[model samples]
Structures are given as C-alpha cells and as structure tokens.
Target: MRCLLVLPLLLAAALAAVPPLLGPTLPPGTELRLLSADLRTLHGAWRVEGRRLLPLSPPLAPKAGQEVQLLLVLPGEKPRAFPGMAERGDVFLPWEKEQVSLLRLLKEVYGLAPPERLWP
Candidate 1:
C-alpha cells in the first residue's frame, strides 16, 4: 500500500526534474548557425560569394540586397552551403523563422544571462 502511494509522488518528482536536466539554458549572446540557401542546383564547389545571414519568413523571403540574420553559437561565424547551392559556387544559410531580431535572437538562443544593468 505504501509503495503504491510513494510511486506516484516519486514519478511526479522525477518528471518535474527532467526538463532542466536535458540541457543547459542558452546564454543571451549565443548564436546558432542555421542554413538558408537552395541546395538542389549546386553540384560540387559550393564555396563562393553568394552566402548571407539566415532569412526571415511570413512577410517575405530573403533576397539579394536584403539583410538576413542568423542565430549562431558564435556571432559572425559563417556556415557552408548545401550541396546544390555549393555546386553553384555560392555560400548561403537556408533556414528561416519569424521571431525577434538578430541581436535578441542571439541573446535568447545562446541562453546568455541577463545583462548586469538589467539585474536588480
């Protein structure tokens, strides 16, 4: 009888602890390198001058002359394009999502602690 009663409580406690243990909270300034270019056309040498930051969606797709942003583990670190895009000889990030601006995304994605000034 006692074992049955204790089991549910133990299970609940264990489940509650699971989420935090899964991963460290990202820092505010950290960034993730996401891809954002077409890879079907490129065949081989993808290293070229066509790459840019990750795109934004909903309002519009990224295009030339537009400033795309990325969430990177390290700011300004560039990533390689996909096979198709590479064959075309251009670099590109291929993923797109709508959210905060690049600077804020970097902070949230990386799980950086709040700024000193913001702290009480």
Candidate 2:
C-alpha cells in the first residue's frame, strides 16, 4: 500500500533527525548523533555562538573499546567529528587533535567569529 511505503520513509526521516545517545545526554545545545560506524554529528549547532564549551551533563567517559565522537555541522554539508578517546572517569574531554578541530569549527559559530577561516 502507498501508506506502507510512505511510513518507512517517514520513519527514516525521523530517525535521521535524532542524534545518537551514548553517555548521559550531553549538555543542552550539543548532541552527538552517530550516523553510522564512522559518521556522526552534533545536531542543532545553529544555536552555538563559539566559546569555551562547558558540559552541563556529567563528563563523557567511554568504556573500554568505546570512543567519543564529535562532529561539526556545516551549512550545505554534513556534520564533522574529531576523533579522540576519553578514558572512564577522566572528567573532561582531552583537547587533542580531534577535539581541537571540533572546537575550531565550533568557534566559528559560538566563539568570536574569526574572518581568516571559513565555516559553513
């Protein structure tokens, strides 16, 4: 039935709109949605203004074999994540390559807008 076909499409669309849930819900205004085994996003980034990100939720500490993914959402493009690891009970995300890259991208939106770099 046409209804059956449309139902799946609607469900798929809705699922795409939702972000991934790993640890405690990340602080408000930030969501890390797992897109697949290798892709993900920080949904609702349009609300960010680029500044030091302080998590409102408890720190993110991945269990063994797990890693935290941070993705950047650019206009007309998909979200991007910097790859890194956070051991359990670390209490903070390390400012490593992936974290710094993610922060640089976010800074374009929330932190003071820099003109030298391009973000979209």
Candidate 3:
C-alpha cells in the first residue's frame, strides 16, 4: 500500500522532468537572415480589415543576408513570432482558430521567399 503512494510521486516527478513539447521561445530583437526576395517587397503585403485586404506599396529591396525581424500581431495582444521553418503545409493555430504557412507569411507579410521558390 505504501509503495503505491510512492509510485504516484515518482511518476509525477518523472513527468515534471520532461521538457515541454513546444519549441523554445525566441527572445525579442533576434535578427533573422533574409532567405527570400519576396520578403523585400513585403511592403506590398495586404492588411485584413473585416475581410478586406487593403494593399500597401512598399519600395524596399532587402538583399540576401539582410537581417530582418518578423513580428505577428494578434487582436488585443502583443506581437510574436516563432523560429524554425516548416517543411510543408499550413501550421494550425488551434488557439487562434486559424492556420498559417510560414512560407506564405514570409512572402505575404514580409515579401520574402527563397529565390528558388514562387510567391503567392
């Protein structure tokens, strides 16, 4: 009987020692390399205003190896972005009820995408 109680405690400790599933959070102001030219024309990215995408003209031309930062702003919260590019498909944000693709965001939001890749 005493062993059972101790077993639960041991299990709890073991689970606590396990690291979280989510990747490590990136610190603010971390510089990222420009991997795509579409990112340079990010200024042309559109904004979502009640299902309307308003266009903006950006005259930026960032070259390869140019340091850039990507920031994402959600309603009523601070801006945030995660590192590490996904191999394919859209990453689902269950909490936000939205799915997003890093490749798309890089091109649409920052106008950047790898030279060998095509922009949407």
Candidate 4:
C-alpha cells in the first residue's frame, strides 16, 4: 500500500516538469520548430489565442515538455535560435531583453502581469 501514496507524488512531479502552455501566456507571431515528435501522425499544430500553426493546414501541435527550438527573428538582425520547451500550446522562450517588451504587451493585452516586473 506504500506504493499508492508514492504514485500520486510521482505523477505530480512528471506533470510539473512539463506543464501545458495555455493561451494568454503567449503573444501572436511566435515561431516554433519541433525537435522530436511525429508530424504525420500528429494533427494540427497549436495556435495563438488557441491558434493553430499554418502552412500545414493543421499545424503541428506542441506537446507539454516537448523539446523545441525558438527562432526569434529580430528586425535588421538574423533570426536567433534559442533553446526552449513547449508548454500547453506555446513555447517558453528563455529570459532575454526582448521579454521586457513582451511582458509589457502581455500586461496590456491580458490585464495581468508577472510580479517580477513589480520588484526592483
């Protein structure tokens, strides 16, 4: 019976490691490339505001904890490839100066903001 208690804890940890990316957590115009997943078998990709990826009609849906590479195409500069992961439907881009602008936009759009901005 000891295994019963441990089961829930193990499950929780696994889920926590790879949480779903939900709408409102991502902005439009985000580009993501799947690293390891079956495309043909997978139907329709995730979209912003629950939008789906295009060019493939049903874009490749990102799975929680799925590995991905982020291509941040900054203006006047070559697109930068950054390592990130998929959560929910959006890829979690690592912290960068550009995120400051992203955070501000999200605040205005969602009326919710990350507390990190409030401190210092």
In TM-score terms, which candidate is top? 4
What tens-digit string does per-residue lDDT give for candidate 2 at 1-120?
999999999977855433332222233344333222244432112222243343333332344334555453443455556444433322123442322333333333234332222121
Q: Candidate 3 lDDT, tens digit per residue, 1-120?
A: 999999999977855543321223222322223222234324123333432323334324433333333334444546554332222222222223343444444334333332223222
**In candidate 1, which residue ranges exceed 4 Å CA deviation?**
1-24, 27-31, 39-99, 108-110, 113-120
Candidate 3: C-alpha RMSD after superposition: 13.4
lDDT of 2: 0.36
TM-scores, all models, native as reference: 0.20, 0.28, 0.29, 0.34
For model 1, state the Cα shift of residue 83 in Å: 18
Residues 1-120, candidate 1, lDDT per residue (tens digit)? 999999999977854433321124433333333233432221111111122222222122233323333323422445422211111112232323312222232233433332221101
Cα RMSD for candidates in order: 14.6, 15.2, 13.4, 14.1
The RMSD (Cα, Å) of candidate 1 is 14.6
lDDT of 4 by residue, 1-120 (tens): 999999999976854443222232454444333343333333232223333332323345556676555443322445445455556544455454322122333334433333222112
Alpha-carbon error at 98 in model 1, in Å? 5.8
**Model 2 alpha-carbon drift over 4 Å, by segment:** 1-47, 50-61, 88-120
TM-score of predicted structure 1: 0.20
Give the residue spans of candidate 4 off by over 4 A: 1-58, 96-120
lDDT agreement with native, every candidate: 0.29, 0.36, 0.36, 0.41
Point out where model 3 deviates above 4 Å.
Answer: 1-45, 49-54, 82-101, 105-120
